[model samples]
Each structure stands twice: as C-alpha cells, then as structure tokens.
Target: MAKVDILNTKGQNVETLELNDNIFSLEPHKDLMYRYLDMQLTNSRAGTASTKTRSEVRGGGRKPWAQKHTGRARAGSIRSPLFRKGGVIFGPKPRDFNKKLNKKMKRLALKSALSLRLSEGNMIILDDISFDTPKTKSMKEVLSALDLTSKKVLMLLPYKEEKYENVKLSAKNISKIKVIIADNPNQGKTNVDGLNLFDLINNEKIILTKDMVKKIEEVLV
Candidate 1:
C-alpha cells in the first residue's frame, strides 16, 4: 500500500489515504506507455482531409479535340490530371484513424502511468472538491493554497452530476488546469481506456479527490 496525505481546500492535512499497490505502485514500462500514448493519439486524429480524383471532377465528359489531328498528344477532357485545374491523383481521403487495445493492456498501462507519477512525487490527494458557484477566483485560491498555481494540473473528479457542474465552470477559465470525470461502465469494475496519456504526461501534477481514489481502487483492484 502507498499512503498519501489528504489535503483540504485550504491545503491543510486533513488525513491520510492508503492506496492499493497494484493500482499505484508498479514498475513503469516505457515501451508500454509509449504504445498506449500512440494508440490514444492515433485514435483521436480526425483523418478528414480529402481531394477529388480525375473522374470525380466536373467538365471532363467531352474531349477537347479529335484524337489524331491535335498537335498535342491524344486530346482528352480538360480536367485531365495533368492540367492546372484537374483533379488530384493519389490524394488523401477521409477515413477513421482509431486504434484499440485489450482491456488487460489498458489496465496495465494505466497502472504503469499512475506508478510513474507516484514515483516522481507528482500526485496530490484531496479530501474533496466543491464550489458554491462558478467562480474562477475561488479555484485560484484553492490552487494557491495547495502550492500548485504555478504548475499544470490534472484534477480527477467523481462522476456526480450536481457536484461537477460548478467545479467545471470554476476551473474552465484557469490556464494549465484540466478536470476529468472518473467514469467506469461496470458498477464495481474499472475501465482505463477513458484516460488520455497526452494530458497525463503534459500536466505537472495530478490531484485526486477521496471518492476518486476509492472509485479507482474499486474498479482497478
């Protein structure tokens, strides 16, 4: 088990939390992390770039001149690929760029990522997070109290519809701060695919609420 101090919004130590070693204390495999990150990024690509082929272009139905008498090579439609306004050859087209990993692999990668963060001492445990209203200043004060205002932060929140709205609005205006709702399809199981590796790597620190810790343990363990 890995134990971390739980801090309140004021940054005071409210208590301590014990984390499951299987979820937060594993040896990080760089290759696995790289693969997971690549998969996530590749899947996110829009892949919408497209171009028309010669046959798809307009005004190409009729030949410009007779086949034998023209000074140039055999006459063809003005929309030939060789012409200036002609359609493109071997051009890009729309397609899906999605990639996938098995449930086991995804779970292992998430554990590895969490382990890496813990080893680097970048993980912060929060007693809880709540907002009276959508106020940016309140969020900033909390960050300052935690001595995290200067760093890029990723905050993991429990999936509570009412509790999230204000927190989301409060943190939206802050630069270098992101909030993600912890979600798992199974009632008592965990799913790791929802996590984004780029965001995890890009942020300097991670803050998790107490309920989030329990939720992760319940699902991952």
Candidate 2:
C-alpha cells in the first residue's frame, strides 16, 4: 500500500490516506500504455477526407470526341483520370477509425497508467472541494491555495449533479485545469470503464476528492 497526505483546499495537510496496492502500487507496463494511447488517438480520428471519383465528377456525361476517328485513337469523358482536372482514383473516403480493446486489456492499461502516475508522485488527494456559486475566481483561488496555479491539474470530481455546477463552471475557463466526474454513490455500480486513459496520461498531476478516492477504489480494485 502507498500512503499519501490528504490535503485541504488551503493546501494544508489534514490527514493521511493509504492507497490500495491493487490500484496504486501495481507495476507500470510501458508497452500496455503505448498500446492504449495509440488506440485512443487512432480511434479519435475523423477520417472524413473524401474525393470525387470519375463517375461522380461533372462534365463526364458527354464524350470529348468520337469513339474511334478524327485523329484520335479513343475518346472518353473529359473527367477521365488520365485527363487534366480529372476525378481522383482510389482516393480517401469517409470512415470510422474506432478500434476496440477487450475488457481485461483496458482494465490493465488503466491500472498501468494510474500506477505510473502514482509512482511519479503526481497524485494528490483532497478532503473535498465545493463552491457556493459558479465563479471562476473561486476556483482560481483554490488552485492558488494548492500551489497549482500554473500546473496542469486533473481534478476527479464526483458524479454529475446540480450541486457540482459551481465547481464545474468555476474551472471551465482556467487553462491547464480539467475537471472530470468520477463514479459516485448516485451511480449504484462502479463505472470504471468510463475512465479515459488519454486524460489520465496527458495531465501532469491527478487530484482526487475524498469521495472519488473510495469510488475509484470500488471500481478499479
């Protein structure tokens, strides 16, 4: 198990938390991380690059000249691929780039990413964070209090609800700060699969609220 200091919004340490070995102390797998990242990036591609084919191009209905005569070996549509301003041949078209990884592999990859972040000492735990109103200044104050003003921070929040609006709106305009909802009691069962590997690996630090700690453990453990 890995023990870490739990801090308050003021950046003061209030308690200690012992993390589950299965979730935070597991060995990091570089290859699995690479595969997961590659899959995620590849799957996000739009693949909407398209081109007009010979049959689809305009001015192709009428033949340029006679089929066989008039000093011409053969004649076809002006939009033929061999002619100038001709339609493309075998060009790219719209498609879906999504790729799938099995359940077990995805779980292992997430664990590997989490373990790597924890080992790098980039993970933090907060007792709780809230705001009465949706104010960006309040959120900035909280980040400043935690000495994360300029750091890329990923705050794992509780599940979606009206109450979280304050914090969500507060952090919206702040650069280098992203808020993601974690599994919560409202959601009876764990939703570990919803965790995004790209966000986890992209951020420089991970900050989990007290509620999120148990929720993640429930799912990941």
Query: lDDT per residue, candidate 2, 89-154, as tens digits?
Result: 999999999888887778788888888998999988999888888999999988899889999999
Q: Please give the distance, in angstroms, between residue 180's alpha carbon in candidate 1 and its true position after superposition.
A: 0.9
Error of 2 at 44 (Å): 1.4
In terms of lDDT, the poorest run of 10 residues in model 1 is: 184-193
lDDT of each: 0.83, 0.83
- For candidate 2, the C-alpha RMSD (Å) to the true structure equals 3.1
TM-score of candidate 1 against the unseen true structure? 0.90
Q: Per-residue CA lDDT of candidate 1, range 1-221, in tens?
A: 88889999999998998889998999987787888889988987999999998888886588888888657788578788888889899999999998888877877888788889988999998988988788899899999999998999998887745566588779999998998876645654443224556777779999888998888777767
lDDT for model 1, please. Answer: 0.83
